[model samples]
Structures are given as structure tokens and as C-alpha cells.
Target: MRNMILAVIGLLLLGCSGGQSSNSTMTVSGVAATGAAVSGTIFLKDSAGHELSMATTDGTFSFDVSALKPPFMLKASWGGKTMYSFAAAAGTANITPLTQMIVAAAASSTDLDAAYQAPSPTTFSTIAANLPAATANLRNSLKPLLASYGADMDPISGKFSANGSGMDGLLDHVAVTSVSGTVSITDRSSGATLFSATASPALANSVSAMNWANDSAAVAQDPDLKVSEAGDGLAVWWSYTGTGYGASVIQARWLNSEQSATQISTATGFAMMPKVAIDGNGNAVVVWMQSDNQLNNVWVNRYVAGSGWGSPKKLTSAVSSATGPSGVPSIAIDAAGNAVIMWNQSDAAVSSHFDVYTSQYSVANNAWSTPAMLSTGTNSAYGYKVVANNSGTAAVIYNQFQRTDGRGGNGDASDIWVATGTTAGGFATRTKVSSSANPIYGQGSLAIDPAGDILAAWIQNNNSGYFDVWASRQPAGGSWEAPKTVANSVTGECYSPEVALDAHGNAFATWEQQLDTEGRQYVAASHYSAASGVWDAPAEISENIGNTYDQHIAVDPSGNATLVWYQIESAAVTVRSAQYLQSSGWGISQLIATMGAAYDGYTVFPVPRVAVNSSGKSIIIWGTGSM
Candidate 1:
């Protein structure tokens, strides 16, 4: 069976403004049928049909139209479809009501508004006619197998079942061994167990069995445990280590609830901090950092929709002495599949100081662009984070220590700096985003909204009693907003702050706070409202599962947030996740995976990273120590 990955792209606009005003101004707000905050292109045209002002990714496009004539039109579009056109007069506050626009499937070419107004029968018939031929082709191809397995086939429902003989025939085609009274299958890379009932020859299985079975008996199959439409047809990139040595390997898999996973590639000598970005054509590009001997290098690989996996290409060949067994790397891929990867590098020239470096991966030519230096000031630049939007615009944020009086002992002062440019090329100038005379020093995380705006959060301790979480944002086409305190650590220290921004400009942030009384780390979070331009009160995302560190947060396009962290207790660490419920608050934190008796002296934990698609589906990937 051939496996294919699907990618969908939708345009979005983000609005950023300065301080609030008391003067009366027009406020436009609406929601789509999918509950996505309605945001897109808004154009103001004059009486003569001349475009006066236009809004792109940034929400508000203002002009000196207050002196212009009256009787203008406010035209808007959302989700790549026109929503409504309103007539308005100058200086009048106008708010367009929420408009419902019909959405068509992938194959439909007719205009959405026209199709909605047409007869119901015509629309249905048109949809049926445009349905892909793959559905029918697949059903017909599996019919013969159904008969041979004595399975009953239902064409309408696309279900197949076998009672006795059918099940026997299906099992005969695949290799299944009994292990400790359980049926198990072993493959070259992994192993899986089949249900006792399914292993029996009396029940006929469906076509899913054949599609998911490994091509060779040496390859293990993945168990299809959960079946949900929410995460169906989703592709996630992750890394896992098998019994191998010499080089680290990271792999990408395209998964669908109804089909087998498609493996992209297994690149070696790379750390498992894998990052992936998909294009509209279902093509994906993955990037990771590989440490060879004592030298660290970054690499990129591509997976086309039809092709399985392409060869891996080296993005950077810089040799350095910073050969540590464990170093975290960060990467981001744009809509064009151009990847911007950043990592800390220690060289002989800058002893004891690690600098952040970045390189770009170009998908058009299947090669990495020239490596560019993102950080310039001093040698104490670290904890680099990067984000890129669909337009190939990228922003990289990091902490830089100003070389003070040629004396360096813990670097009394630090500052956060940001560099932005089109991924096309030429990143020569970097702007300092954080204005801290006596800045705090720690690792930070960054997120880019659809409009290419940026949000950065980190932990800083400027001789204060305890470290606190600080956040700043660069609104669309505007400089970074003043840094504000997101959470205060009165007793203990707050560290490892991470932030993620949704399509609606809503920012979700998470961090680890150490309580002085118990010396336990608790996970906390806060939400920033775009409508009110203020952060909601800080809320605890994790509970009971105390004594944790290295927390990461992810926000979906619909403003849903998920936070994952590692909890250490009794000298062992466990992974846990807490999901946010906008309707009823946060759900109870649940433990995801645990390290058992095989715990080594080193920490056995998962360093979580997450991404969300336009459909609000999310994928999280993390690494764990050997058990």
C-alpha cells in the first residue's frame, strides 16, 4: 500500500497596536463557523472605488482617512474566502456582524458563495461528482482479498469482516508468534502485539490489517489503539533511538488514524531535537543537529508526497570543541519548507562562552543556504529560539551579555535581542528587543503568530529575591512591546519559560516555579488577550505532580493550550501533560510516560516540543534517556 501525507494552508491576518485610546474607534470582531476568530484582509475603499487603506497579516490598517469623504465600503475576507462587504460613512464606528460562509471540499472549484446559494441537490451532486477516485479504487482492489479471507465486505460503509475461515487466511499471510500466552510480531526496528481475539482464525479482520502489516516479518507493526476523527490524517515528525551506535538518528513519520505510518528518514549523528514544517502539497522538510566526534553540525531532509524519503543534506559543517554528550537544539521550518535552525556553539576563540548560530534550508533547490551569524555582541550568547511565518519571515531571539569592563564573572548584565528578515536571504542587522540595564540570564522560548509577529518569554533574576517570568511581544510592523511580568516567584525561583501564540494573537506561556518551602518545581501559565491587550491572571497548569522542571507550552490555532513537563520525585523523573479547556478551565494533569526500574543515574525524561496545524490538530515530540 502506498502512503501519502496531506497538508493544508490557510492565510491569516494579525493586528498589533500601541497603547489603548479613550477616543471612540471602530472595533471589528467576529467568529467563523469552525469557531476560529475571524481575521483576514480588510480593505477600505473610497466613493470612487479607490483603495484608501489595506490590512494584511496585521489586523488594523489605519490611515488619515478621517478627512476623506463619506459613503465608503469595508470589504473583508477570512479563511481565504470573502466574508462580507459593508457600506459605511467616515468617522462612524462600524462593526460587521459575523458572516457564515460555506466551505467546499478540496476538489471543488466553484465559488463558495455561489455554491451556497444554488439548489441543495445541485450542490450535493457537484460534491459527489468531484469525490476522489481513490476511494472507489481502494475498495475494488481489496474486494478479492475479502473473498479469500471469507470476510464480508460492505461497500457503502467501507467495512470488512471475517468470521472463521477468513480470519485464518488473513493470519496466514502475516507472521504472528505466541510470546508468554500473547501473540507478538517482531520487525527490524520495533515490536507489536496482536489481540488474542484478533489472533484467532475465527474472526475476519478488515482491510486495515493488510494496509498496516509490515512488508517484512522482521519489521514490527505499530498498534492502532486510538481511533478519533480529530487527529485523523495528521502527520507528525519525531525521533527514536533503536539498537545502533556511531551517530544519533532522528525520524519523521506521517500518521493517519485509518492507515499505516509512513517513515520519512532515519538520519544519523543528530540530536533528537527534530523540527518539521509542511507545505500545501503535503511535502515536508525536517531539520536536526548532528554532533560528529567533537564537532556539531546541522542537517536537513525532505519528504515529498509521492516519494518516500530523500537523502539527507548537511546544512552546516562548522567544526567546534563543544562536543557535549547532551545539548539541546532548536529549529523552525516555514511554509516554503525553508528551515532556520539555531544551536549553541563553543569554539576555541570564545572559550567558556557559547554563541548562537543559524543556517537556512532551501527546499526549492534542495540545499542549505549559507550559514549566517545571528548573534554578534560578546561571547555569552545562549538559549537561542527562532520562529518563522508562512511568508518566510523569521525572527530569532536570544540573550546576549554586554562585555562589561573586560571582566566576566557571571556577567552582571544581560539583554534579550531579536533579529528579523525575509528567509529569502540577507540578515545583517539585528534589533535589541529587550531593554534591561541589569538583565536576567536564562534560556527562553519564542513563537510567531500567522502575521509574522513575535512573542518571547524568559526567566530573569536581577538581584531580586527570586527569578520571575518576563514576556514581550513584537506586534505586526511594530517594535517589541515593553517587557511585562507574567508571573512572580515570591519564594522560590522561576525558570525555563516557554511561549506559544495562536492565530488570534492570543499568547499562552508556561514555566517552572520552585517553591522555597518544599524546593519543588510547579508549572504555571498565563494567557494574553488580544482584544483587551492585557494578560489574564496567572494560573497553575500542573498540580499534585510536583517537583518538575523544563516545562513547554503549545497553543493550537483555536486558542487551545497544552503544557508538558518533567516531574522529579524520589530521585526519578516522569513525564506529564496538562490540557487547557477554554470552556471549563484546565483538565487534570495526566502522566504520559514513566521510567521504570531501568532508571540510570542520569535523568530519564521527555523534553517536549509541540506544533499545531490550521485545523487545530496538535503533534508533540520529545526525547527520553535510555531505559
Candidate 2:
């Protein structure tokens, strides 16, 4: 089927000023379907998305429109219907009476409200309030396009009507960079096109093209288990290489349980390892590394509650001697939707010329600060893991290897360091997390409680021809607790530690270990009691049948948890899972699926990610294969 190209029909035009001025002026005009006089408010907005002027519409609308600059946007809306269009200012800009009809006919107020509440991955809501009932932290950051709305009557038809232009806002935000872009509306189900247009680069990345679905909720998916405090939804992000494009593009998809997934990646490039941070409201911030024709740079995209995803903004400039290609990005969002993204890039100042760099997202300014170096005087740093709590403070922990100061036990040893940040003050100086100079292996994981307390897990060299999982805890605004062994000394070659903090302040830690007794690898877990400040004995969770690898766990608000992993023994690989009840310990491990032919004789590695909400709803995703 051919894609829908909505033809925006126009009527008449009007303006307050008869002549031109310092800036270009655009006048928008509209008329009732019946050719009768109607009333509604018209708003004039600046290029920065700030409201400039508003007036009553009497079958026509007009404004100075000078602040909006060239390629201006005009909107005419009333009740549940709004029609908006973009054009250059040679003369008057014409608009349709009902460019977008939310309801067939405004028979009742409830019908109008329902149209306003419907969700569309391509469309955005006009209201700017924080929808606590839907999700406390969910919000549409687009400033209101209208100052207010009122009730009016048709002069000729004598019918009551909603007297306000329906246009909520436009992508008139201040441009982060002057790159031209396109705006497109797509079908979440099939990636089919609905409507699209070329626009200033700022507008293209700031809004998603959308059309409403015929349902109570908007069409979307929650594959990442990022349940919306505003409602039930999930979100996930990834990057895939393209054949013809010659560059990889970052991808994001979100949906409710009943809806199909919506893809939010608008551009293609050499993007990889996309990371996400969803707030309590299901609003998300996605960050990834993309290589232009030249070098890799860090870019970020944001989803406004009710509105959908916005444009991607570059966080780093071209790679200079001062900085190299940005990669291995990680991000965390606070309850308020504020976010922080960090990555390791080449810096001339660092000893190895590669150091940890970070940028903080400001909701007030709707922009990211220039990338700043967080690791200084360190020989080399990488493997950054970051997490933010409700209080807006974030903890970043990464490995600093081959130090010039010789603090590490071995000259080549590496240690984990922690950095903290707030909206007011960016990341503080690095704090050594691991005590010894021994090498820390893999990426470190950090989790923060509501009170700002933190728990971290990582693999460290035991120095006795073996490796073990170590743990650390920090009280709110206090010094770190001495690192302690979280694993049983039952074997060697233990690593890949992951940590999760439940609502009750309990910290759950899981890791992979080689079993000498069984001559195989197994998964082990332990629980930490916040009240007693003690850790329970480690328990083996995987069967001895095969090599247990890539374990993932997510706990609901009730403290119930689900763990997923893949086991490879011989020719066939099996995906297995188990449940952990608060009162009863782990349930029987169950078979999720079997995969052998899927590999097609090629070597395969799987790392599953899991997320669960309070009601036991879980979303599990993995690469190569999924359960």
C-alpha cells in the first residue's frame, strides 16, 4: 500500500501588521467547514519555542511572527482538532480548519478529552502538565503553544465550541547545531510510512511523526520493561549495521503490552552499543556512539512523556588531539528525567591519551553540556557503569588501569574508581573504589537506592591463581565500606558480577563461577540485608548439566525476582530460567527454549538483559537469540 501523504489544504490569511519589519512575518488563516464564523485562540511562538503572543480567532488568525524567523510554523486548532503547517515567509501562511481531526465530531466533552488522551508513537500531546495518574515522572517538555483555552459560541450556527487552537507546540526549540533534517511519521507495527517532510535539523530530531490508533491507549511496546509510572509500557534500544547505507544506525522501540513496537531511530550512520535510561514515567534517554565519515561521536535522543521521541543531538565535536572517537556509552536518568551520559575517548592530557568523559543533560535548557574529562592523572580508564537515584545524584564507576602513581599492586593492574555528580555540580573527582592494586576485570556494575546509598559489584583478582567476585557499599553521602568478598571460596575463575537493589534496600548480587567439583561453570547469587548490614551465604542457581553463562536478573517491587541464562553443553544450547520468591528462595529451574540449529555451526555468545515491574511483569531480551 502506498504511504499517506496528508495534503494540507489552506483557506485565508490575516495579520496584525500590514507591512514587513526587522524580521519576517508569517500570517496564518483558516475558516469553519460550513463557511461560518468560529472562535478560537491563536498563539505566536518564537523559534526557541517560547510563547510570544496569543489572540482570539474569528474565522481568521494573525501575528507578528517575526521572532520565529524564516521557515516559520503555523497552527490552527480548536477542541480536539489541530492543523499545523510549516512554510517560508514570502507572504501570508494559510492553514486548514481541521488539519488533524482527533474526533469525527465534537458531540460531547468526553469524546474530546478521549481524543486528547489517545497515544500515537508518531503524534504528541498538546498538554504540558506532568501526568502523575499516567506516570508521576512522565512529562511533555514542549512548552505550551497556547496561553489558555476558553469556551465560545458560533456566531452564525449558535453552537457551543472549544475556543482554542489545538496546536500544542512546534519543534521551534533552539537548534543545538545547524544540521538540516527530516520529520517522519511511521507505523509502529510494520515500519510503514504514514507522513513525512523535510525540516530544519532541530525540528526533525525533536518530534516523532504519529497518527492515533483506534484504542483506549496509544500503540506502543514495552520490550525493555520500563513500566511507565504514567502507565504500563516498556522500552528498549539497540544498533544494527545497514547494508546499502554502509553505516550502523541506532534503534529504539517502545510499546504497551497490546501494541506493536515503534522504532525511533531517524538517521543512519555507524552507530553501535546504544544505551538507555528510562525514568519512572517511562520517558527515556538514549545515547550511542556514531561515526560520521570521519570519527566517532556521542549522540543522545530524548522521549518527552506523551509526546514521543525527539531529535538526536551530538555531544562531542570532531576528534582532535584533545579528544578521540567516543564509544562505549552509558547513561542514567533520575526520577525527574534528568540524565547523565559517559564514555571513554582519546584525550591528549591523559597518559594513555584515552580517559573517561561525561556530559550532563539539563531539562531546564533542553541541552547537554560540553563533554568534560572525569578521570585525570590516570594512566588509562574505560569500562564506565553509571546509575542515578530518585534524588538526582548519579554514581559512575569505571576501571582505571596501568596507573602512573603505582597504587595498583602490579604495575599493569587496574582498579575501579567511583565518581558522583548532580545537576548543579557535574561529576566530582574520581574516588578509588577497589582497595587493592590488583586488576579488576570486565565492566563494573553500580546500583543506587532511593536514599542515595550505593552498592557495587565487580570481578577482582584474588592473587592466589584465582579470581573472585567482590562487593562494596556506600551509605548516603558517606565514605565507602571496605570491599568484601561476596562469593564462596569454593572455586577459581569466578567473574562477571551483577548487582541489583530492591525497594527494601536489599542488595542482590549474582556472578559466574567455575565449579571444581562438577568440572563446569555455574551461576551463584547472594542477598544482602540492609537492616542487619550482612550478606547471606552464596547459593548456586544453575544446574551442573552445562556451562552456565550470561546470567541476568530483575526483581519486582515485591522483592520477587526472575533470573535468565543460557546453558551450553554439547551440540545444543538451552535457555533456562528460575524464579526467586521473597519468603521461599528459588523455585525449580525451567527450560525456556533450545537453540542449536539457530547457530548454524557458527560460534554464538548470548547476553540476556531483564527488567521487571512490581506486578511481576517482566521483559527479557538477548542478542543472537531471545527467550
Candidate 3:
């Protein structure tokens, strides 16, 4: 009987090894040529059009195929475009043929014979043939004027003189005949024409000029404060404008309500990164960085429920000089309305020195405690992101880099570190949550669960020689689980990760990814599951919108997540928002407002920030040119 049992165990072990050897595993890897991965879906399909798998993250992907098939093709899609496609055999490994996949993913004719063909004027002649005769007559009227200007039409702005004199003299001689035309704007999703009007050339020109001037002014302001929510309700905070200079305290009841803003305080210098948290009695604690006399310092202010705003108190005594504290700062408030602020301070006096500092403000005593150092190491510490639970506990996450490290040259090798504290004050020590061997480079964001578990997300330079969005979760008292790549895309760089945790601990992360073809920036998002210990494949949130950057995501109490970002449209940066529908995926994007026109020969980049409350409403604030 013992001999029989041993024979059975040996056969079972041999069977397991044979099964593993027979399985075919293929790993897909590629890098985005642009800044990040574009939003879209990728699927592995067989010859019969059967879907085998899908990819969400941007960087690299792996698949284990038990069944063998020759010439299996994988397709990657984003927006209305298929960004990549490649063929694989039954036993292939390390598939990195990105060129062919990129070519197939471009906007071109699928027909093999027509692949290289470019459409000529003849291709559009059919549409021209259907044009009204009056339209042709209008074109004929401009021909003589265009010919007089050497084949280029100088209609609105007359040709300038060679001596660089004003063109108003030439403009007087040109006569623009009034031609009535109809304009129509249709809702693409609803198949309804929302607006239609008829106007003459003079009216059109007047409206165009007005719009141009408005957009121009809007862009010139650089950073402008926008109200996210308002009117005596739940969780209200104010956003700063003017290159993140100063902010006011805005009170709001819900997301869509108009905000009643009260100027909290403004220094002669700039202020930025203002954070606000509300206590049970409707009191608010606000903290931000202030700059004056070339020195950037931290400040805090409080607003009582019945009383008015309190006097601004300076938290940091660091002088802003050639070497001073810099980068973005974060703040959180506890139930007692005490404020906890964290910021990165550089000590130029010490070699290889940068540290994360924290301080506490007591509402009862109306005083701030002495600042405490949270990180102790040789590397430069930066990118301090903090979150506070009402239970007087706050968690801070930041990137720590070792100077002169060979890994990514200087400032290349970094990792995410987390520090937890019982009070909304100083941290005892910070522990490294990310793996030490595989360090992350870019800045990361953090979200804390109701139970005090910490979830952090950041962009990491992976072993595949590309950057991808990675996430790490640490239970309340346990060590951090292994880091996992959330979104898999190989077309571009992924950076600026922001995460939001719902009440149930569901995590949603959003970041900017690059497209393979146009090199346009796109927004991608994914969710982390605690039970499965796996990140759901990332999905593109914005499809029609392109050139998106600085995406911020927030989750409502209903477990729905809303994503907001700045997108370039018609040469202006516009703030756009998209909400995640429970069963319908992402809703159609809506444009919030346009920032303004080009500034100093370049369009201003809109770095909008967003926050949402438990009531399924959100407030989005951004800087823009004044009207």
C-alpha cells in the first residue's frame, strides 16, 4: 500500500510539471512615444474574431494561453481609433513589435491596396458638387480680392505694407458683401440639434471678434479661481487663482449650487495649494503656502460656524530665498478642527538635504505646535500628499529619492513612503510602502480608507524600460501588499497619478497617458479590488476630448467616480468633466469653461483640480483668464 501511494504522488507531481510546461505564456510590452497612454480598450482576438483578453494599464501586459494557436492577433483601441495590433504564435514570448502595431492603429484605409493612398481634391469633389449655387457665387466674389493679394485671401485682416505700417489703409478699400448663413450645433449623443441660427457676415465677424478677445483675456490670467461648490452645505473649500497665488473661503451646500466666497486673506506675495476640511459643527480649517519677500512660508486660517474668519497665522518661519521650501503643500483637518499641514522643505545649509515637515494647529489653544521632521534619510524628499480621517488620524505619502544614485541618474530613483499619526499633528516615523528594489520616480497621490488603510498610486519606471501606473495598498496594521501595475499601455509615458477611495474602500485612480500616433494626451482610469488583490484593467475616460493633462479624480458616496482635467480646444485650455456611471461606463464629457487665450506666444496650460463629496456631487476649480 505504501509503494502504491508513493507511485500515485510521483505521478501527480509529474502531471503538474507537465501541465505548466505545456501552457503557452506571452508577455506584451511597449512604450508610449508621447507623455502618457491614451484612453482606450485593448483586446486579444483569435482568427475567428473571438476575444481572448484585454489590457487596461499602459506599459506592458502578459497573457498565459493554455490552448495553442498560430498567428494570433491582439488589437488595442482608444477613442474611435485602433492604436495597435500585432500577431503572435502559440509559444511566443516578449512580443515587442510595436511599429507594425502602431501603423495598423493609425487613421488610414484598412484596404491593403489603399493603405498608402492619400486622398486628393477629387476625393472631396462629390461633397462640393452638392453645394448650393449661391455658395459658389460667394466664392467667385472673393477670387479677384484673393488674386490681388497674390493668391492668399486677406479678408478680415488686410495685407500689411512692406514698411510695416498699419493695414487699416488697405482695409478701407476692401468691401465685404453681406451673405446670410445658417449655423447649427447638434448633440452628438442625443442626435438633437441644440442650436441653429442664421446670420450675416457682419454679425459673424462681430461675434467672432468678441469671442477671440474673451478667450484671449481668459488665457492671460494664467490661474483663476473657479467655484466648485457653494452655499452653506457639506464640505466646502476655496481654490486659488493667478498662478496659484491666493484663495478665498467659499461656502457651498451642494455641487451645483452657487458659492458664497469670502476672501480669507491674501499676502503681498503669492499663495498656493489651499486645503480645507470641515468639522461637525460646520467650522473649517484651511492651510496653504504663502510667499512674501522672496520667502515661501506656510499659513493657516480658521472659520467658525457662527463667527467670521480668523486671523491668518504663519506656520513656517523658513525664508524663501535662493534656497528655500518649495513644491506643493497639503493640509488636512480633524473632527476638532485642528489642522495638520505637510510640505517639502529644502535645507540648503546641509549636503543632499531635503525633508518632509509637519505641524499641528490647535483650535482650542489657537496656536501651532513646533514643526517636526517626518523623514530622516540621505535622499531628497518631495511630493508630499496627505489625507486625514475624521478620527484624528492623518496619513502622509511622499516620494524619497537618493541623490547621485546610478539608477535613473540623479533624481531618477525614488519610492513612495507612508507615515501615519494618531493626532492630526506630527508623525513619529515614516515607513517605505513601495518595494525598495524597484523604486518609483514620479510624484504620487494617496487615499485613506475609512478603516485607516492607506492606498497610494504613482507612475513607476518599470523593468520593461517604460513608465506605468502602479498602486500599493497597506492595511491598517499590516505591511503593504506587493505593488501591482494597474494600467498596461506601451505607447507612451504615464504620470501624475491621483487616487480616491470610497467609503467601502473601492479605489479609483486617474492619470494622463500618451497616444501612439498623434502624441496627444489622454485620461485613463482603473479600480483596485481589495478582495481579489488585482487591479481592474484601465479604461479610457475621455475619448472625443484630446490633449488632456493634470487629471484629478474623486469618488462619491455612491461609489461613482468623477474625473476632471484640462483639455486644449480651439487653441484654448478648457476644463472638462466626466462622471463614471454605475452600469453605463463613463458619461459624455461636458466642458466646464475655457481658461483664456494664448499667452506670450504659447497657450496657457490649465492645471485644474477637482474634489467630490459623499452626496454624489463634485466641485471642479481651475485657473483661467478673467472675463
Candidate 4:
């Protein structure tokens, strides 16, 4: 009887132990997102580099952690980037870019892979202890965004869905990137920075919002944004589809002390490609191509210092109801508010041929002069770019097709030509600047210095059938230098060169270079030092991931420059930029805008434009199809 009773007690103890084991099976669950649902595998890992649980998720995930340990790391991989989250107790942990930022801040390091591969009990404890503070710091940094999106719940441990609401909405409008132990938060729509500093506990307390320029809205493509040399004024213009007119119209915004977007073009057909320039005295000149049902004409508008945008003025005439049009307008303004405008207009007498034309804006009279024919070429000429110096000297460059040059028309082979003039439209004799054997020199960009020196950059096909970047320098009151190749890749083509010159005559040029026959292009830049009188070897300014194009560069009086471009990689399109300092060389490229996944196929890759002031203050603007 005693042996039987002892056996019964042992059985009762075993039953109780099994019941406790069944009750202690804990499961961790949450959502994984990066604007769009992370439709990938989510892994739950421990501090010991052990994968505790793995599950495929459409964003929401659950991990059975009954047999796992504490201090877990949740990772979601997508878009070739890994996002992470930390869970001390494993209740709910959402894997996201922001959560990874918080984890990085708590650990005082951005090398998350290193930490994840080699974490100790002490390291895990330290991260757990600092998680709250890090969370608060990230929240503070994103206060405005959180408030705007109404995301009051905790990002890591919150019960949120990846359905474009709450935390998902916040994620849609911001881009969080970690580099060199620092975290940067930028507005996704505008690329306006919100916070950039070391991922530490003091981040939110020491940093204020850098997104004051956010308008919470977007414009159409081909927007031009410029800043004054004094850094006190800003002007932006773009062409957008009008509601009542059922056609595209040009609109502008001037910010000195107050501003709002005002439509400058009253076109019934379409007004497009609005380019703007702001002078030192807070004055601005905007020019665009407006259609009058039969022919497209160039129009101009001026914004006075104290007043708003003046009425739109037509600079070119729609001579006849013929199909010939005047378009591709470019503008520049001098320090004294003098302006120069350039465009290509069809020669009424010559069919199917276009000629370059120029018009000047007088600050004294606040009126644009009559369009003057600058290119006397009987051959077709187009792709005009213009720039103005502080002394009111303007420079223009274009490409003119030759009738037959034995070499090869290759479907309209052209030569690059340049000319200089005054703000009063009196241009000097046109000079052919490019002497390349390949007659197809195009994509010309022009820049002028305070002393009236001009730099022209273009691309011409080499004998190998690959396009290469070529640039020439015309010294103040001197002849044009022989065009030199600045960038030549062995297997790919380079095109769309943009050049900018500072007051000291230093020139910076950037262009898009093809990576493969698959149509992948990367941004490459070369610096031309006036002191050295040589173009530096070209450097790749962007990653070789996408097709980059529409690159535009601007320089201030102090030799500081800002270059902007847009890249399309897969279904994602991004606006990116790089800064050039005379003292430090070119800085690393940065993200200016990241179009959200909601409009993946419908995304509009706007031609990103940037302007910088002498103080290095810059404002970049681009258009979008949707928010």
C-alpha cells in the first residue's frame, strides 16, 4: 500500500508539470511594413545568433516563441534592405525601418548586422535598458509626422495594421536611413530633411525639424525652384493640368516674407516647361512654352520684390495658324534683375526647320524685349540652354543639324554651337564650340561666371558608337578652348550633361552614364578647377542601381553647388542629390524624395531641379503625379 501511494504522488507531480508547460507557450506577433506591406519572410532571432522562429508574412506575422529565449530581434527583408525590431518581452514587435532606427539608436551603433551576429548577454541587457529612451528620442524626432498621421501608438509594440493608416501612413511620408552610425529622417514627398544626427539618446532633444519647407502637397513635372544669392528669397514654378481650362497651365510661388502658388500662364491649349530664376534683390523671372491651339509660343512673367507675380507676357509670336511651334524655353537672371530667355522657334520661311531665338527682360521697364533670332543657321537648330552673369552678360548654347557631311547624318547629325550676349538681346556672332568627328553633339548645358567666362558641356558619339561627355571653356573676352572628353566609359554611353560655374570660374559637370545595354544609367560628375585649368577624372556620384536622368546642377558665388536627378529602379523612383564644396569636394549623394508604393506604376519621375545660395542654403523641387 505504501509503494502504491508513492507512485500516485509521482504521477500527480508529473501531470502538474505538463500542465504548466502547456500554459507557458508564448507567441509573438506584429506587422511588418515599409510604406507597403513587407510581403516577405519574417525571422525571429535571439541574441545568440540563433533563429528562433520563421514565418512568411504579407505584413502581419506571428512567431511561436514557446521554446525560444528572451531579448529577441525581429527582422523583415525587402527591397534588398533589412528592417529590424527589438522585443524585450516578446509581446508585440513590428518590424519596420523606424523600428530599426530605434534599435540602432538604443545600441549606439548602426552596424546592426554586426551586433546581431555577435551579441552577448550584457549587450542585450544594455539594449533592453536603453530601448525606452531610444523610442522616445525617435518619437520626438518624428513628432510632426506622428501628429500629422495621428499615430499615437508605439511603433514597435503597437497593435497597428499595414493598411495605409496610422503608423503605415507615417511610414509612407518619411524615409529613414542609417549611415556611418548616424540616422537621417527626411520627408518622402519633398526630400526635405527632418532630422539628421548620430543615433543617440540626445537626438530628439538637440535637433529641431528641418522640414519647414514642407507644403504637404506636390506639383506636376518640370518644376524649377531657385534661391537668391542672399539666401533670403525663393521662387518655384511648374506646369500642371488645369481644372477649368482642361489644359496645362504654369504656376509659380515666391517666398520672401509670404507666398502662395499663383498661376502665371493663361493658356487655353497647354503651357509647359516653366523655368524660373531669382536675382539677388528677390526679383524673379519665369518663362514657359504656351500653345495657342495652332502654334506654341514662349511666354514670360516677372515677380517684383515687394509685389507678386506680374501678368504673363508673350515673348514669341504665333505668326501663323501653321503647325510650326516655338518651345524648349530656358531662362536666367542677373544680380541686377536683368534676365535672358532662349528657345527654339520654327523658321516660318523654312519648313520643318527650327532656329534659336532670345529675348531679354529689363528691370527698369519690367518688360520683355522682342524675340531676336540668334542662330542664323539655315539648318535646323534646337536644344538651347542659357545662363547670365552678374554683369548682365548672357551665354547660350545649342545644336544645329548639318545638311550632309559625308561622315553620317545618323538621322540628323548636329554640331554644338555657343554665343554670348547682353541682357538687351544683342548677341555676338555664333561660334561652333564642338569639333568632334561625330556630328551628333547634343544635350548641351551652359554656365557663366561673374567675369563672363562660359563653360559648355555636351555629349557626342565616339567612333565606338558610344556617347561620351565633352566640355569646352570660353574664357572671358577670349576664344573657345578645344572641346575635351571628360568622361568615357568602355562599354556604355553617357548623355544629358549639365554644367554649372561659380563666380570664380570653377565648373562642375554631371551626367547620366549607361551601365549596361539593359538601359541602366548612373550619375557621374567631374570637376573643372579654374586654378588647374583641367577637368578632374570623372567620379561615379550615384549607385549603379537604376536609370538616372534629367540631372541639373547649380552653383553659387562661393563655388558651392547642388546637383539633382531622378532615378527609376524597378517600380521605385527616387529623387537624389549631391553637394559640391570648393573646400571638401563632392559629398555623398543623399535621398531627396522617395515615391511611396501606392503610386508605383503611376509615379511621375519629375526632372529634379536645385538652386543654391552663397551661404550653401538650397531648395530642391520636383513634380509628382500623386501624393
Top candidate by lDDT: 4
Measured on C-alpha atoms, candidate 2 has an lDDT of: 0.55
Per residue, candidate 4 scores C-alpha lDDT tens digits across 1-627 of: 001111000111112334533345466677777776676677777766568545443576777665666788777876677888898864778777888888988888787777776767777878888999888866755654576677866788776544566776787777888765557777776765555545643342122233223232255555677766544435445555756443788877543333356788885667877888888787888888877656788888788877777888776763343326887788888888888888887755566677777878787886667777777646777888888877788888998887622122346767899987787656876799997478565888888888999999888877787889998999999999988888877779888888888888888888887867565678888988899898999888877667777777777677767677777767577777776655456767776666655434234444566666654455566665432
Model 1, poorest ten-residue lDDT window? 1-10
- For residue 420, model 4's alpha carbon misses the true position, in angstroms, by 1.1
Judge candidate 1 at residue 280 and give its lDDT: 51
State the RMSD for candidate 1.
20.6
Candidate 2: misplaced stretches above 4 Å?
Answer: 1-225, 230-233, 239-241, 257-263, 318-321, 348-352, 405-411, 488-490, 569-571, 600-602, 614-616, 625-627
Worst 10 residues of 2 by lDDT: 168-177
Query: What lDDT does each candidate get?
Result: 0.51, 0.55, 0.52, 0.71
Query: Arrange candidates by lDDT, highest first: which order?
Result: 4, 2, 3, 1
Best TM-score among the predictions, by candidate number = 4
**Candidate 3: regions farther than 4 A off:** 1-261, 318-323, 403-412, 570-572, 599-603, 625-627
User: How far off is model 4, as Cα RMSD?
Assistant: 13.4
RMSD of each: 20.6, 18.2, 25.8, 13.4
Off by over 4 Å in 4: 1-218, 230-235, 238-246, 255-259, 318-323, 404-410, 517-519, 598-603, 625-627
Order the candidate numbers by TM-score, best to worst: 4, 2, 1, 3
Candidate 4, overall lDDT? Answer: 0.71
The digit string of per-residue lDDT tens for model 2 on 380-464 reads 7777878887679888988887557513333467778888777436876567878775666745888886778888878877767
Between prediction 1 and prediction 2, which has the larger TM-score? 2
Cα lDDT of model 3 by residue, 209-252, tens digit:
00111232232223222112221223233343534433323222
